[model samples]
Target: MAYLQQAPAWFLWLASLGALYVSAFLPRLLVYLTHCLRRPEDLRLRYGTWAVVTGPTSGIGRSVALELARRGLNLVLVDLDAANLHEVSGTIMSRHAVQTMAVVFDLSLVSTRKGDEALRRLRDAVKKLDVGILVNNAGIAKPGAVFLHEADVEAWVRMIRVNLWAVTEVTAAVLPGMLRRGRGAIVNMGSASSEGINSFPLHTMYSATKRYVAQFSRSLYVEYKSKGIDVQCQAPFFVSTTMASGFAAAWRSSALVPTADTYARAAVGWIGKGSPLCVPNLRHRLLGWYLAAVPGGVQDWFCLRENLRHRKMLRSARSPRASACRPHGHGIPSIE
Candidate 1:
């Protein structure tokens, strides 16, 4: 009693703050445990049997399609790459014995006349099917990790179109069926650059578009929750996809970077569950928390430094004089 009464004002305030922080943290930790340990919702039963995955030819999109197929969901596989899309469709059908329909559509041109025709076709194809899951996973980051001034401005335009407009238009096309059926799940792929850190120096436009995705999903979740629709944004830090392979090699020597298949497995468990904004992988959750606690300026510094280094390596590889560096990475910028 005497010791407590004698506590200084600053000490009391600090103690109260610490207690409040823990009070909030514990419940969240419990929720995460429940989400991770619980049985995943059955897609075919809860949502419908048909899952539509954009950018389904590779990376996170491809893996998610396969996982859904494994769970006995037929798929509407969409991508700009005709050959790879067909191959993936065939693979899923053969291995999982699930049906797959591949659509070769360019998302970057979603607002154009050509995109209208493609989207109309997409709508017509899926309108009759039971599309319970929609993964808005098609995305691109062309001329990546360069300064705003140094990047090709058209590349930025294309990125915005693919990342933003495509997501919006596609959702619009699919939402009607979900509304009629009164059940569906929409998973929007996001990045930790937008969700965890306040700034992404070298990858400005990419992060901005992803930030939009996170907010878009959160808002849509709120809007559609009572309507029997699940809108979730999955913000991942880094996966072993070719998109992250170059810079991730320098970040923890890629030890922390999960493979697409590994991430996909974890991600599916989180679908239509928990907060609309979710960090799926356990490692990425830790990293996001750590990065969130760090000073914003420090985060800016580290992001800029690593991104700058990655950009330099990218340029060197492209330079005619530096022929030793490998030229292409498969599965990056799925739209282009």
Candidate 2:
């Protein structure tokens, strides 16, 4: 008691430091112990079964389909563009020699009644295959100013239908089989904008839809983790795809834009790891970290200014008779 009472300040400081060290290491030690006690399946490869990839005609979706085919997984490719669908499917079949099925349907057009019909068709088509992977990669976005005065409500509704509703519909169609099989993986293609941004003024509806996808994936993971299902929300930065060519050239220099193949490869790697959220590229990871750590008001101020500048650049790119920038020598296709 006397020794304790008379202990030097430096001695107390040293003791405190030792305690902190133990506290820091204890969690890791416990985790290691728990891991050792868990079943081998907990650490084994969870990918490589029958897979479905939406929007598998171009960009990231096509890349993912190719990568999965290379891994020896049979694929079901979904897309609205029948011509591109045929092109991509033919390429994958000839290159990989994997069994491939192509389905052409506008998921955005399927309502509750139509969704039932679509789901029935999808179910009937894949009923024979042991599907273990679902890539919800279909989405649409319209480029414009953010404010209601400039925003197109019809376009916003269409974007929401394609980006959000289709994900729900497809997942609902495939989840039951996965649950019964006791093993599966679902990867939802999200956007970096889902975390909320003050800088990009025109993506209000797009960002909101992406946020919904992220949240939905998280909730589904929590709900189905015990059933041997892994859900991953992949949020990637600007890619050199036609969809983002204008934005990439305006916001980030061409040197910084990642190609669709790069993003797809990284996303597959993350899926293999059973990661809950995959953010490709170090720059995007750092940006997410900083945005989450910064004060809301300060982030908003910076974001608003950046968004205004970005809007101006997009407007300039949209000038009549202006030539649309091409990436990878592929001219942008007219959707209309």
Best by lDDT: 1
Clashing residue pairs in candidate 2 are: 198-303, 199-303, 199-307
Per-residue lDDT over 1-336 for candidate 2, one digit per residue giving the tens place of the 0 to 100 score:
799679999998988877876676567445534543444342124644689999988888889898888777889888877788889889998988688887776887767576567667787777777888999998876644455467667777778888998899889888888888888899999987765344444566777888899999989988998898889898876776767743433445555467788767666655634347667554555455446545778866765676577666656555654445434454443221
| Top-scoring candidate (TM-score) | 1
Cα deviation of 240 in candidate 2 (Å)? 2.0
Name the weakest run of 10 consecutive residues (lDDT summed) in model 2. 35-44
Candidates in order, TM-scores: namely 0.89, 0.77
In model 2, where do residues sit more than 4 Å from their true spots?
1-48, 112-116, 196-200, 246-250, 254-256, 272-275, 290-295, 316-336
* Error at 247, model 1, angstroms: 3.4
lDDT of 1 by residue, 20-62 (tens): 7678767877888888998767778999989899998888989
Residue 200, candidate 2: Cα error in Å is 4.2
The lDDT of each candidate is: 0.85, 0.73
